[model samples]
Target: MAALVPFSLLRNYSPFMLARPFIVKGCNLNFSKSVLPLPCRRLPFSARATHDEQAAAKAAAATADSGAPTIFDKIINKEIPSSIVYEDEKVLAFRDINPQAPVHVLVIPKVRDGLTELAKAEARHGEILGQLLYAARIVAEKEGILDGFRVVLNSGPSACQSVYHLHLHVLGGRQMNWPPG
Candidate 1:
């Protein structure tokens, strides 16, 4: 273990003591250092979104609803086209139309059973919820992202849930960032 020197002592030491290369007895020691990037002075956002984008964002956040049918119903009933990834008697897994990642799939229960959102889930929903999560894993396996995948549930408007139906988004195929937006 390297010796621990107080930071105050660093200021008093010669500039040669704090260097990328510190030599001792004709032997050069290479020590790498990480320098944090300086804080940006620019605005937090690059540009303002257009009216349509703002409206869409608002709509995405307006799904704090219940006991309502959404587009997922049509997809479930085969009334609409969806690329089915995995399916069983209880749960259905399909590819997301607007995918956030290369391997993106949506998992949901065949019957809503009043489970419009995760926050509204009750004890009766335990079995189906487990099935949905299992189906998500099956989707990950089929999509070749079983090694690293994410299961996401947007419960309400604050979570950016556009559809009122309860569904899990299985995303993978790249490095996911921390503190997801």
Candidate 2:
């Protein structure tokens, strides 16, 4: 017998589609009636994203690679107050608003120079890219987690890159794990 998809599942797509029958494999499936169970099981934390994370990801997707001035620009210009950890001619390191680890810092270039994201990096951006990585190390050292730390760069919305400006996240202060989400 063919399986019927839940009308509830089709509600999000198109209500009119529920009356249509679709064939898959060797059986015809109708979406008007639900033969499957409702209320799916909760996924484990390691395989699931929290509500807040999901929301952030959606927001990131909306604004990904826009090439617009981001909050980091304000932080760099001193318009927005940030807990500055390190600053120099080219790079600025500060505490992250949403810390992923006990010690979390963001290392960004003072001037974006069209380096909105790592994927947008050009040959000329090699210098600033190196500087950002070096700044991450400095941040890790100053945070007293030089022995163990992780540097992460979420390139696009698919990678959860909320900020458009190219930046590196320096995280430490606790034991880290593999396959970091």
Candidate 3:
């Protein structure tokens, strides 16, 4: 296994590495963008504090809580350059900023259309929903994960859906466990 690096190491490393976000497993290590503060003192990854209260506060502060614009809009508008995997008039597929597996991509719709989360979907959203799922397949194929893949859609805060925008996580390239945590 690759050795786990510390987020603080970026401060001493080159500036270029600090400018971009990278992930190990599903945890986001972007210090600049992280809402959960990293410990300044020496502590192992497992020993670091898990602030459930702080996490809850951050989730409550989610932008556009009532179905308004989210950061995904910026990616779709090309304002924020993403590592796009697949794109079309109706859907967009890009690598997850925080990946869960060797092959992890996020498939989302070009237009949210009130679909802030999968649980918000209505009859009118059926077509676009299908398109998003199909786009996940395209991403899986491009990433060469045809043997197996897991498509995950986190619908609410309880499911750890941090961003309010609807997204389908296409994860593969590893043996996934049942009864997902």
How close is every model to the real structure, measured as TM-score? 0.67, 0.69, 0.69
By lDDT, highest first, what's the ranking? 2, 3, 1
Candidate 3 Cα lDDT to native:
0.73
lDDT of 3 by residue, 60-174 (tens): 4466366556778999998898999999889999988756577889999888888888888899999999998889888988999988999999877667677777889999986
**Number of backbone collisions per candidate:** 0, 0, 0
lDDT of each: 0.72, 0.75, 0.73
- The candidate scoring highest on lDDT is 2
- Tens-digit per-residue lDDT, 66-144, candidate 2: 6666899999989999999999999999999867667889999999888878999999999999989988888888889
Q: Model 3, residue 172: displacement in angstroms?
A: 0.7
Candidate 1 residue-wise lDDT, 1-181, digit = tens = 3543434323322333344333222234223443222223332222342344445646865654545567889998999999998888888888898776668899989898888889989999999998988888888888899899999998776665667788999999755667666
